[model samples]
Target: MTAWETERVAWAYLSRVTQGPSRVVSDFVERYGVVEAVRAIKSGVVPRVVAERVSARAHIDTAAADLDAVAALGGRLVIPTDDEWPAWRLVGFQTGEFGGRADTSVPLALWVIGGRSLLDVTERAVAVVGTRAATAYGEHVAGEISGDMAVDGWTVVSGGAFGIDGVAHRAAMGVGGVTVAVLACGVDRAYPAGHARLLQQITSSGLVVSEYALGTTPAKHRFLARNRLVAAFGEGVVVVEAGWRSGARNTASWARSLGRPVVAVPGPVTSASSAGCHRMIRESEARLVSNARDVVEEIGSALSGDDEQDHLFSRGDDRITGPAILVLDALPGSGSLGPHEISELSGVPMSDVRAALVMLEMESLVVRDDTGWARAQRRR
Candidate 1:
């Protein structure tokens, strides 16, 4: 068969619901030409070669009807040649590390949905992932980092699951920023049905993506495999919270292997939720980030260290002297303080305090949650 026909057959085979059998067929096609591979599968001669690799079954016929159905489900079956396919995928797939197996298991096609194209969104993206049973602190930090990245014109990417992943997606959406959910399941059937609405919002504002085809269910192992794509697509990976064997840490490992920067959030010393993060820091696998600015500064420094020195969070040309600056310094990290309280704490006049508060609020430098104003976005 021609190369085009071979690729189409490979894609079609990979899109089937059956996993091992389809992979065997696809691998055979990938190794040899499609005509010979199809003949081997049909003649049952291919099973012995892959008998130790996967449980084989009869060759499944490719169907136009199934391909059409995938399209009808708002899914785009994208090949490497597609205009919207990420150029990075070519580079990523060629690496063959971290379960990527570019030689054997590179995705034949990806199913995509949502507003931003995969290629466009991945250009300025970061992955924020962690344990599904993350602590409250983990979720909070993920939201802050993801939200800030979104506002800074970077897409926040994560798997659309519970805990840190969900928090990141919600916070980005709250700020009218783009967030993409990279799923292990098909985009048509957003797994963890609880995130259905959140996934819809994401699709409207950004995208929901997966390597699986339409009507596929999420598998435990698939998510571990999915982390590779999250790492492959992002410039960096941030682990907000993780345990000894958390999947987020898996992504971090993959990111490091791929030569991307990794960042980890520091939490309470006693909390098991943060043990993995601390370990990462100790092992020199990632940098510690207390707030969004720390992350931005790191990324900016990598791009151009000079740009980082240009801005120093100063109120003026001097080190520090503005009411807003003083107010921010005085506010508590976890809770809000009213204008009167802030005025008292900063020792600034009430009127100046009020004006600074307003200005800060307008710039989203501070937020008022029922009681009073406090730092909104994390300090740079």
Candidate 2:
């Protein structure tokens, strides 16, 4: 084997020997390169931190077998050295804070199943995630947002499970758009068993990715580990509906840490399934997104430049389109007016007026009441 071929086996070995977010392993590889790091790790001549994390699995070197197994399944391991590796996404990922407990770092290798490149689908991706115990309203919202995004050539990333995740995958695919499913188990396995057909279809054009080696079973910790990647792959993460302790909420946390924009869809206050989303909004951890447009705007704001002004009221921000600005300027500062009145005053079409109002409402610059729409009270 050539040097790179040998390095590929080393990457596969490190991936199996160490779980995700292992800073020591990442640093070791960065310092000494993949081949040398694997030798030192296997020979028990590494740093204590690396030793602690890899000692248990160091003896297990199924690099060749694992590579062949995944290849047999029409997949391959994407290491950092690969030309298509998405180094841009991990630009400023602060692994230290996240890895303090899990003792992991950025993904060493992603086992991916799909003909399309990982960067291609993930380049303009957004994560639409929510509760497994979804309500009719929740599922509907997830589908609408995900479908709209997919149609606009933006890929949807999500955990491959029931409810919202399943809805996102199906919606993205329904529109003939690309989507990536970040699996908690091995890519070779069909998790949830029920979504076997869904997983199989995803691999047809989109991607099914995982950190776990082949044949690894799904577990709670593995799912948590998988959440980080789902958050990372997306430029932004949208939580459609989440309960008090949903995994979707956890993904949102990862998004925040990764500096990825976090958006949430509100549900009826009475619905237990939406409580998590509401809480995130209340805590200011996530921006409230009611529709696809709101999601797009937020994601655009985050990617455009410094995100500190994402929630700030900037008159020049591109997120504030001309129609929205006109709509805002047309509104009476003290009172309210209906859409027709606003459209007439702003010289914007009715359709544009309505769209602008929704965008304004999401930005907290406008509010709709029983009477009509009015400028929201500005904070001091």
Candidate 3:
């Protein structure tokens, strides 16, 4: 078979052999060798371990079914060999079996649905993850950090769940900035149905991606697995609002394992929701971020170029147009605005405001603060 055909068949076997989506492809390579693994799978004589893993685990078939379902839904499955695959996956994969106690997982492939190029977007990306049961403080802080990150021309990557995840994605999309959603389930299946429309919006404007295949339904453990991808794919992981034992903490641990920088947003000392972040900061495992500019300055060296500001906020635009520029102009020199405020000031519809903020934020021209509003960063 051709290389692509081999990859496709190997993926098919991958769908069948591994119980967990995290190791499906990599394990196939480890056990059978890449080429032989694909051949064995197509020949229907997959190893006994592979067969046992596939047959015994309900998730194995569910993972494969996800691929089939996505194919049926007009979504394409992207394997490692795919041209569009993000190169950042290598960072996580290379971090295997560290001296540290914590182990981070990596996915074999990504399933993406969106206009944005995952590779292009992640060239300068940062992840913002936090509690699902976020507080007003958490949500507000998440919005600001994520929004400002987007303004700096850094794509914001996160889990596509509620609270911090939803708000982070919204902050990026609100500004027409490129954001990527790393899902625990299939790209075709939108879990947390409340975010269905948001998922659609992401696929259209940014990217909705998964390591899991198409039809796989999300289980509790899957989110933890997905968290690794979120951490691994970015330059660093920022925790905006995580509680003690929050899943976002898992992502933070993964970031630590990979030697990626971690940033946390401080919240009310008495709030249970703030405990996790405080612990991270107190432990010195994460740096504390009070606003978007801090996040930028913290990771500023990792950013591709100082010229990102000129690219994002330029007025005599050629490719960029309309609301993106207006939102850029709307940002004040300090103290960020929430999406609503950005909308009001930019005269861009509330719907487009977030996307604009994301664009400007990723380019490093704007930032969001604890108040959850976008503001222009005060440059030296």
Minimal lDDT window, size 10, model 1: 305-314
In model 1, which residue pairs have backbone atoms overlapping below 3 Å?
A: none
TM for every model, in the order presented, reads 0.69, 0.79, 0.71
Task: Predict model 2's lDDT versus the native.
Answer: 0.84
- Candidates 1 and 2, the one with greater lDDT: 2
TM-score result, candidate 1: 0.69
Residues 1-380, candidate 2: write the lDDT tens digits: 99888998999898888856577788788788789999999899988988998999999999999999889999999987576676555533532245454633678889999989996777779999999999999999999999999999999999989999999999999999998999988898899999999999999979999988888888898888789889878988999999988999889988887777899999999999999999999999899999999999998877655333322212334466546766777787589999999987655789988999999898878999988899887665
Residue 38 of model 1, lDDT score = 50
| lDDT agreement of model 3 with the native | 0.70
Q: Supply the TM-score for candidate 3.
A: 0.71
1-380, model 1: which lDDT tens digit per residue? 66764555555554553341235545566566555655555566765745433234345554345456666766556655455666443243333344534222445567777656777787678888888888988988898888888888888889998999999989888899888888888678857888888898888888888777666678877776688778867777889988867888888886766656789998998999898999999899889988778887765554332221122122222222255655665677678988888877655678978887777677666788888776675445
